[model samples]
Target: MADTPQANPQTARVLSVSELNRMARDILERNFPLFWVSGEISNMTRAASGHWYFSLKDSGAQVRCVMFRGRNSYLDWVPKEGDKVEARATVTLYEARGDFQLTIEFLQRAGLGALFEAFEKLKQKLQAEGLFDETRKRAIPAFPKQIGIVTSADAAALHDVLTTLRRRMPGIPVVIYPTPVQGKGAANLIANAIETASRRAECDVLIVCRGGGSIEDLWQFNEEIVARAIVNCSMPVISGVGHETDFTIADFAADRRAPTPTAAAEMASPNREALLNTLLQQQQSLQRSMSYKLNRYMQQLDFLARRLLSPAQQLTHKQESLAQLGTRLQNSMLQLLGRQQEKLLRLSLNLQHLNPNAVLNRGYALVQTRDGAIVRASSQIAAGDPVNLRFAEGSAEADIRSTAKPD
Candidate 1:
């Protein structure tokens, strides 16, 4: 296992090729614990049996690594040629070929680990302060009247954002708050630009953005000051600082996060064609509402017209009612007079029937005694000697000597 040179046969014990290989493997495995190796990938090969074979090398040295299906199947990502990566592996020599190699259990791309660590730390810190909370984030304007851009003037991201805005909505104005997006002191400049944009309040929304780059190139956006500036911006801020796969603290702190500068422009600007269509729809809706209100008013007018009356017609109706009442009163008076006349005539006939002249006409007579006494009895006539008699029409005087008795 030590790869010692062959000793003289006079006193040395010999080892077979297989024995040598086996001992070497045991010694290598025992000498090295699991360790990380960083290098670029080269000559990568995948066998039909799902085993990966590759060499990790820098300018000075190289080592072969084997990642079998069992371990690799759990990996979310795979390495490609020329990609810088770190492998966690144990050093071993293959027993069959006596080749020294590494048995890799895990692999990760290089450079990202440090950046990712910083990203997560800032992200969590800002999140705990409610910077990334949905409730605290501002809404992206559906249609920005004016757009403010905070990025380096020479950056391709500015061009991308400008081009996208022009394409989507040409008439919308854009204000650029230029700042350095890389190198020393760039983060402070970016933060100052964001604060300036917020203070100016010239645009409806703000886009803090830059072109894609390596982590170091985009490091300005990950700074705490830049993140705080984004959080403190008066208008909604859209972050488009890197490629889609790249993320930064500003992205988390922004009101809205866009994957790229062009995307940020698209997010902040409304499409003119789409706006035209929407305006058409709203116009049609307004017309419909006006039409409905007009129809309702027209119906009310018709109802009022039906209820309305001309003065002549109103007067005619009232006069006709009055004439009907007058006719009824005249008929009532005539009936009352006729009934009274009939009653009077009937009373007059009864009075005539009870008249004394009428009773005399029926041959009734009256008699009186002389000296103003009537003599109807024989005893009274003998004493009186004289009597007066009256017929129905005249009066007469008579004397009675005897009375006559009649049954």
Candidate 2:
């Protein structure tokens, strides 16, 4: 024998419990992919940390399962013990306990898998056809004159909607088109009622609503006929079906989606109290503006009245001005007459000094030739010339004496 192949203690491989468990978990995770499992829930416990601990078992086997808070928080409904459910999970081993387990990513009611698949398929088809395009949606009237409703006559949803409408706006008229909202042929009847409302064209807006229920109970709204009818309706349509957590195909096709029937009525009507408040504010503003304008106009009228003059006062002022002008004219004329008289007296004195007859009266004789030329010098008279002499009062005719030079 080859010395019995003695093992070396220093070279032998050994693993701790934690390392072994970790290796097993990695191996299980790598081998089994995430997959769906269907079973009844048992040993359900909701931890204070919001995590869920449970066991999924069938008739033959059971497995430990855990769903973290992040995963279960998005679920609309809570799962309970003895509830049949489907889980999508991955296989793993708990490192501390050395136990095999599953970590769940999603959970749903056991039989709803087919329904969810159908809903997703239809949603994708309609989206591809542009049925859910925002451009195709109509605008909801802010003040609808008339409202129309399509629902079962006996539905509690109808009562809720009517009460909301009446409370918000009682003056607006509401027309109801009774139709079946559930059961075998409910989709076709709802479509007919919508089409009838559209043809009549009596309402500014339409509401199609029903109360909350399970997915199966609300499945009629997921039909193609109802969606097409909502898309083709003449007026804007508001769809309020099921609770806030529930959604149907009609919600996508409608102009607006409400969480409940009461919300849909609120969307279609305006509040009377709010409108009255706005009107009151506007009326007060108008009254203040008018009062300000009237006061300003009255002040202007008073100012103009002060500036205005009477016809009699105007005539009296003109007469006073005319009298003053006449007095000034009379003074000017008297001064002019006195100046003219003084000028005439000076001229008369000058003329008297230049008169030849006045010189003759002062012992001087005026001599002239017979032809009437006055003799100014002794040289102008000749010894044989005939001459005439005139005094201030008489005239004499004589032969010229001899002329002599004055010594």
Candidate 3:
């Protein structure tokens, strides 16, 4: 056969099973990028190493799937058999087993893709409008006078919240604005209830709450009207809807968010025991302060009492001082009278030395004419018609018979 195309050894290369499988895996991975695949989970197996091995099946065909522990651990809910799911995965071949498989990175419920898309779109729109701004948020009151709840009257969440409130603080009054929290037109009902509560302005704080459920069931809380109602509420609103992992648009608009219905009640009411303990401590402090002040005042009063004098004692002291002053005044007057008497005696002795009557008493006679003129010398009496001589005790009148000269 024309030497039948002799085999070219260099052109034709042989591949081992391992090499072939590896080439196939690389080709599959390169060709099929990571994309979402929707199917019902079947033959689910949770390996001891925390990895998940399962088969994704549809009406026609099924494919082996694997999710590593690191990827699956982040899911809030565990995947069970026959659960409809959507996995984001890349097609690949297991080299060791030489089998086609998909490596899953992320997963979620199947129909939730559209809901998630709508949620994201709305969130972006609201966030851009500053509806979720922190500055717009209000602070919850520390001591709410009255609490209002907007929820279904028969809901288990209501019971939990009421129980919590009763246990923590029985004195606080609770008002219920009953409404449907789910089903058709539930959003409008919830909004109306919130508006009514705001209009009444009866409660210091409003709690809008419901129990946990699937996203579709809790979708009312995600409605724009519910969110706007919460934001526009006159009283501070607390949103407590769904489980801890679940989130709704109302949570963002509310002034505060609680993880559960009971937690919301706890946030609204203060602990009775704690308030009592604080009041007791304050009372004790006031008593101690008053007691200290009273003791100080009492001691001051005692000291004043020791220094104070009775009215009778004060009168006696005044009387003694007046007696001493009177005695001093009497002595001063007596001394002045004695000095005056001595001065008078000295003046009398001086008067006696200069007295003309004393000279007459010493046997000196005074001569005078008839007209009472005194004659000092015999010449003064010469040829006088009449003359008088006066002694110390008597005066005599006589006529001059003759004039005489005396040696």
- In terms of TM-score, the best-performing candidate is 2
- Compose the digit string of candidate 1's lDDT tens values, residues 73-192: 766467789999978899999888878999999887787678778888888888898988999988888878899999989999999999988888999999999999999999999999
Off by over 4 Å in 3: 1-78, 86-107, 306-407
Off by over 4 Å in 1: 1-80, 86-108, 128-145, 154-156, 163-171, 183-185, 199-201, 213-217, 243-245, 266-283, 353-360, 365-407
Model 2: how far residue 130 lies from native, Å: 3.5
State, as a TM-score between 0 and 1, how close model 1 is to the true structure: 0.61
Specify the highest-lDDT model's number.
2
Which pairs in model 1 have colliding backbones?
368-374, 369-373, 369-374, 370-387
Instruction: Locate the minimum summed-lDDT window of 10 residues in model 1.
Output: 375-384
The regions of model 2 sitting more than 4 angstroms off are: 1-78, 84-113, 243-246, 316-407
Compose the digit string of candidate 2's lDDT tens values, residues 1-407: 56778778789877889989999999999999999999999999999999999999999999999999998876767999999999999999989898899999989889998998998898899889999999999999999999999999999999999999999999999999999999999999999999999999999999999998767888899998999999999999999998877799999999999999999999999988888998999999999999999999999999998787688877887898888989988988888988988999899888899999889989899889999999999888889899999999999998975889888
Between the candidate structures 1 and 2, which one is better when assessed by TM-score?
2
What value of lDDT does candidate 2 attain over all alpha carbons? 0.93
Consecutive 10-residue window with the lowest summed lDDT within model 2: 1-10
Candidate achieving higher lDDT, 1 or 3: 3
Candidate 2 structure, TM-score to reference: 0.64
